[model samples]
Target: MLSKVITIAQQKGGTGKTTLAVHLALAFVKYHNLKVVIIDTDPQGSLGKWFMVRSKKNSLNKNLTFKTASLWGAQYESKTFKKDHDIIIIDTPPKIESDARPSIEAADLVLIPMTPSHVDFWATEAIIEIAKKAQKKVLVQINRANQRSKLINKTHEYINSIKVSATNIIIGNRQIYPSSMGEGKTAVEKQKKSKAVEEIKKLSEQILLELK
Candidate 1:
């Protein structure tokens, strides 16, 4: 089987790109039973930091591995990593830059996480363009959505207005996500029965369907 590359990207920061990358990696290993590797292309190294916590806490999954890539390049890095893993999840930087393009280019599917706001939706155009230039499929989602708000419908329309494929699943803004991550735990380990956990499980299913 070919290794699938899923790049979690958004042109703007605070759009929950890293969150998606990390959790999706865990979901693939824990729920989908796939060998997963996370490549952090973001200079911020947020994913790497979490992996450190996992190692320190002994929570690291043997099936999941983490690696970091330089901002200077990635086309070569992506190709090399896929040789060993079932899924190569790339966490790209929060901008459309020389670095992010190669990561998006290397993706089989690029996931754009948008907050439920006009600004977040508007920020997606440039990254989506880069993904299209690379001819990669994209899935847009209202990530960290305010579950109690009515704007979810508007966000859906906005995503569609831009002619991008939108996933029916939306991730909610919940304290549990970060709290669990801080402790080197994922929803699968901490809040197995919580709403946040269910959202991630659904996201994995939607993502699989999109990949098909």
Candidate 2:
């Protein structure tokens, strides 16, 4: 199958972009049984570090591939990966405004993760505009949020006001997400039957529909 590129982007830091990318990559590989390649375009190199840990633990997974590149380089690299992989995920650095276009343009979908805070709301529009200008599909992912917070309502309002699609499943502020990543495993791989695993599974299903 030809690969579909999904670029996880956020203009602000601490939005869990790297974590989301790795989780989604693993979900596609394990649950969907797809060949996945994740490209780390962020200079922070967090994704590469996680992949290294996973490699040592699993002796390098055959279904999952990890690579690094610049934002511009990712556009070219994702195209080449499409020949064999079923999914290509690019994790980008924070605060990359206009420089984010090459990566966004390469994506079949641009996923923007935001917490239910006013600060994250403020930081989201610039990247949304960039994705809009690039004529790419954009999905706002609500991450690390408390389910009962009133802010969740406001977040949906904000997404509607901005006129972008969002996933119906919100990634909760679950400990399993970060703790598993720290051990080079996903919730699906670590706990197997936890809420975090279910959230990722549903989110991955939603993303696959969007890609189709």
Candidate 3:
């Protein structure tokens, strides 16, 4: 079988879409020892920056390599990606433009990350509609959740009422995420055994199971 392509997308920014993509890619490489390639499709190139820093520091293992590719290059990259790689994770821009459409269309699964807010939820719906139209498997990751907040609980309930499969893994708001990313390190590597790493790991496992 061909490699599984996973696209991380969200119409609204600051939802940790790129963070999830990078950590998940690292998790697959670190834990499963899978040959993984990350396609930095976002114009911001957050994933690319992370890869560069990690490469400079020799933080990543030999099993993984993150490559930078334009949104327009997604089809070509996917076509030419090595069969030896276990998975290809694509980080898309924060809009539903023509460029972003191709990444979503080419993906085996589309993951939409959002916070527990009405605006974020609405934006997620728009993305989900597009994914549904493209006939792609769509999943939502609730990022930066506050367990004690009523809004978070309500948002979770609302998401469950929807037809899409919302991931049970909830990534809480943590200082480590912003602090470590500033140094070009992933939360998992910077704060090992922290809650943030554990949550991201669970999310990664759920994604792998779905792909399986």
Candidate 4:
């Protein structure tokens, strides 16, 4: 089994950090048949709330596990989870700055999600530097994006200048993402064939390859 810890982090709020965490967790389970555990380090408890909804709906999957921990505590918890789970995803609160180090250090890869905007690009640097300083591999995820927008090219240029790898598969700005979460299901589970599902599957495949 491939045991890896991925920390989804962003210094700015509303970057879809929690959303990415749950989707990736479910995608790994549903599509890759991997044992996945998601640790909610965000005090807002969005991930925990989503899990609660899933449990109430009796829709919980055996391959998926949910836990709560502080960002600092995630490092220790992930080590313990690594023994049994194929992947441990740490969902962190935004604006954590230096406090994000422990989680970053725990991860084999730090997955930073950002929108294709100058504001998001500016906010991404701190987390990226923290991850790079820890000598951990980093993958930047462009989330909730409009692929046709002119800003898309500018986003690529910024990423290139920073010399960090960004995913080829960009997660589009879709209502299905938030709507599916409301039902405690991912887009992949809520719909069999859709653009959202396609993006997630391709992303999971790419991430799994990077982990190997």
Best by lDDT: 4
Question: Candidate 1: global Cα-lDDT?
Answer: 0.82
The TM-score of predicted model 1 comes to 0.94
Between candidates 1 and 4, the one scoring higher on TM-score is 4
Ranking by TM-score: 4, 2, 1, 3
Q: What TM-score number comes out for model 3?
A: 0.91
Model 1, poorest ten-residue lDDT window? 69-78
Error of 2 at 119 (Å): 0.3
Question: What number of clashing residue pairs does each candidate have, in the order they appear?
Answer: 0, 0, 0, 0
Q: Candidate 4 overall Cα lDDT vs. reference?
A: 0.94
Write down the TM-score of every candidate: 0.94, 0.98, 0.91, 0.99
* Alpha-carbon lDDT, every model: 0.82, 0.92, 0.80, 0.94
Where is model 3 more than 4 Å wrong at Cα?
none
Error of 2 at 35 (Å): 0.5
Best-first order by lDDT: 4, 2, 1, 3
Clashing pairs in 4: none
lDDT of 2 by residue, 64-182 (tens): 98999999999999999999999999999999999999999999999999999999999999999999988999999999999999999999999999999899999999988889888
Off by over 4 Å in 1: none
lDDT, candidate 4, 1-212, per-residue tens: 67899999999999999989999999999989999999999999999999999999999688999999998999999999999899999999999999999999999999999899999999999999999999999999999899899888898899999999998999999999999999988898899999999999999999999999
